[model samples]
Target: MLRRVREGLHRWPAVARLVAIAALLLVAAAAHLAARSEPAGRWLPLLVVAVVGALVAGAPRHRWPLPAIWLVATVLAVTRGSAVDPGATAAALGVGAVALVAALTADVVPVLRTRHRRGER
Candidate 1:
């Protein structure tokens, strides 16, 4: 299933990535709105930032460290806030896990570099 998803996205290149990023942003917005009781104005910017970071790091040429930095910063900000609702836990966990995996290895960077190099040739 995961392989199929990856392959399907790979078939369309930038379009697929853009759609995926947009969907991720939508999800973030929805999650933020649903999970937190605070004013939308407060968390909307953070949601936007998260989406922007995800989009920037969505490409094959982007290093995992870039996204990792964004994720770390976001997590710190979220935690520092006075209240954290349980509903946002899924997004936090999922993205956090991805960032952790990226931080622990050079997998994403090397794969992207190789693909980029091949494309250049």
Candidate 2:
């Protein structure tokens, strides 16, 4: 599934890919900024997003990290204004888990697929 999705987008024109990624990041940034200004806006996540976005979308080198970036940015956008209550904590943990899975899948699945393809050859 991952490979299929990657293969589908892999051939897209670079402008189209950049537009898609920019749209995603712009939406996330708008949401992030719309929330009541908080001093706790984590730079680390934004940094990760920039680096991953560059690697996946800017360079046309990978596809998995883009989804992880989207997941993280979306979750963070949705939860930006919330306090550290129990419910929010639980939700945060869940989002983190999903993002972790996304990142891992993006990084590992391609390697496995390549190895499998090589073995078949």
Candidate 3:
């Protein structure tokens, strides 16, 4: 069973990323709704679009940057503007940004090492 799980992970990094992003987005969306004073204007719709944009780009090779970019945007918007509930946006966006950066960096480092190994051989 363990072996099977490992193989599945190897074959589907994208799925892992997709699931992670979806989970984070759920938390953010819920928080956005639950906040005592979320914006009454366009922030809700923008947040929705950001979540969907991340979802649509959830490929391991490509979507690696999507969540990070989304999170940064969210963070900036929250910090600079008075749209969404800052605390809720900060929590979800912070975690999502960090996780995506780590995952994508780890993924790329391995490829670079493998290429160097081939060159040496």
Each candidate's lDDT (Cα)? 0.55, 0.53, 0.57
Error of 1 at 39 (Å): 9.8
TM-score of 3: 0.43
Q: What residue pairs clash in candidate 3, if any at all?
A: none
Q: What is the per-residue lDDT of model 2 for residues 59-120, given as tens digits with 9 covering 90 to 100?
A: 43454554455456546755666543444444444654676576677778889999999999
Our model 2 lands, by Cα RMSD against the true structure, at 9.3
Q: Is candidate 2 or 3 superior in TM-score?
A: 3
Query: Per-residue lDDT tens digits of candidate 3, residues 16-111?
Result: 566556645653554344332455353456555555544444434554554555565555556655656656666657666686888788778989
lDDT of 1 by residue, 1-121 (tens): 6456556667877866675466455545544453444566765676566555444434424445444544554455466574766546446556656865775566667678889999998
lDDT of 2 at 35: 32
Candidate 1 yields a Cα-based lDDT of: 0.55
A best-first ranking of the candidates according to their TM-score comes to 3, 2, 1
For candidate 1, what is the TM-score?
Answer: 0.33
Task: Rank candidates by lDDT, best first.
Answer: 3, 1, 2
Q: How accurate is candidate 3 locally (lDDT)?
A: 0.57
Q: Regarding TM-score, does 1 or 2 come out ahead?
A: 2
How many clashes in candidate 3? 0
